[model samples]
Target: MPSTTGSATAPLRVDARPELTGDRRIAVLLSHGFTGSPASMRPWGEHLAELGYGVRAPLLPGHGTTWQDLNRHTWAQWTATIREVFEELSATHDAVVVGGLSMGGAQVLRLAADVGDRVAGVMVVNPAVSTLRRDVRLLPVLKHVVPSFPAIGNDIKKAGMDESGYQRTPLKAVHSMMRAWPQLIADLPQVTAPLVYFRSATDNVVDDSSEPIILGRVSSTDVTRVPLPESYHVATLDNDAPTIFARSAEFVARVTG
Candidate 1:
């Protein structure tokens, strides 16, 4: 059976070449969340690719690995990597649309703000924009005084559903995300591309505050919010994934056309 646990040494690759032709179609750059691999975005990318849209899902830095590896990298590294991928995709295709899961979604928002004119549209799934509470403020202290493994399983209710099954979340990694949150929140108003926001009703990772923060702040004239009622934080791999894939395909088609 194929490994569902993901990998640290080996990164997941999107089977994108088969879907690409010389049609000069719109390009789609898919980004995964913090601690996630390109595999997380593969379904959406493949679905878009099948429709003759060029799709690319690049693995973020320090991801597809153990939590310790993730702790070693900063949010900026991941953002830079995705930005480069977005530029490459935009240069190669006629129109460019960017999408991501969780933190990847946050990064995409930053990308839209920083390079709005270069992008045709944006598709975000459970984009994390705000901290659920000030308690996240404690992360900085915990990373030094406590071990990350002991507290790892406490946050996850559906252990069986964790594709990576990571029991050890790098304390520093969670802290890094928290630090990045403030900047993403501040940059929300700069986004000018048409936006498609997908949210999971049962998500435990990102709080409900995200919807208002994104919907109320982004400057995009066309902002569509779709609720994923059947999935959790990793909705891309859960029950409503097909909905995400299909909706994303439709959104890409409409925006890029």
Candidate 2:
């Protein structure tokens, strides 16, 4: 869970124009989770690129640095970063599918709602917007008293593999995200793009609280839920990652075709 500094944590963009390539030229925007950097998603991005898809994974604001700096960023900044990447990709790419992990999932849902059919499709891994944790009830006051809590990073079942995220959780940033859930949920029906949700059967960081809400409210009649039994919350970096990578390529092909 400890932070690590390297090019691995930097933002990644793999450009492959449709004019040069063929059907696989569809672009995909991959967003990382909160307290997590691009490192967590780099492998998946690379995999998609290997399949001939253009890929981008942006480091959210205040991430790839320190947890203390993460507290300085709000949900707006984080969401804006993803939105910007979508805009950038949309400008050149004929079609762009948006996807994310954890908080990144929620952020892409926001984009799906905002841009509607402009998004070719949607994919999410362990996307979380709600929690069953009881301690969050005290965030209103506790955020002011305590700066952060223990790390929620490195919740992977994969041994020796780190998510390369913060070693601590920033309470203020946590509160900001939690506060925006109501609006995000309210806007769920606005999301009409085809959605493929990749959820881990057992996740330590994000519970099943968000699944029902997203699946039930989304207006997209075309929805598929794939369960990953062999991984934890950071399933993108876990054993079932290949399942995700392969299925995700098929998903992009299905939606973009």
Q: Give the Cα error of residue 190 in candidate 2, in Å.
A: 0.7
Which ten-residue region of model 1 has the weakest summed lDDT? Answer: 1-10
Model-by-model lDDT, in order? 0.74, 0.90
Task: Encode model 1's per-residue lDDT on 1-257: one tens digit a residue.
Answer: 12223442233333233234344557788888766767667666667766677667777777766667777888888889988987777666678889888888998998998896688899998888775677667888888876464323222233444445255667787787778777888888889889998888877777888889888988999988888887888787778888888888788778766
Give the per-residue lDDT digits (tens) of candidate 2, residues 1-257. Answer: 11223587898878764653474457999999989989889889888877667888998999999999999999999988888989988997889999999999999999999999999999999998899999999999999999999999888998988778999999999999999999999999999999999999889999989999999999999999998999999999999999999989899988998
C-alpha TM-scores of all predictions? 0.86, 0.95
Candidate 2 global Cα RMSD: 3.5
Alpha-carbon runs more than 4 Å astray in model 2? 1-6, 17-25
Pick the TM-score winner.
2
Any residue pairs clashing in model 2, and if so which?
Answer: none
| Candidate 2 worst ten-residue window by lDDT | 1-10
lDDT of 2 at 257: 85
How far out, in Å, is residue 35 in model 1?
1.6
What lDDT score is found at residue 113 in candidate 1? 87
lDDT of 1 at 249: 79
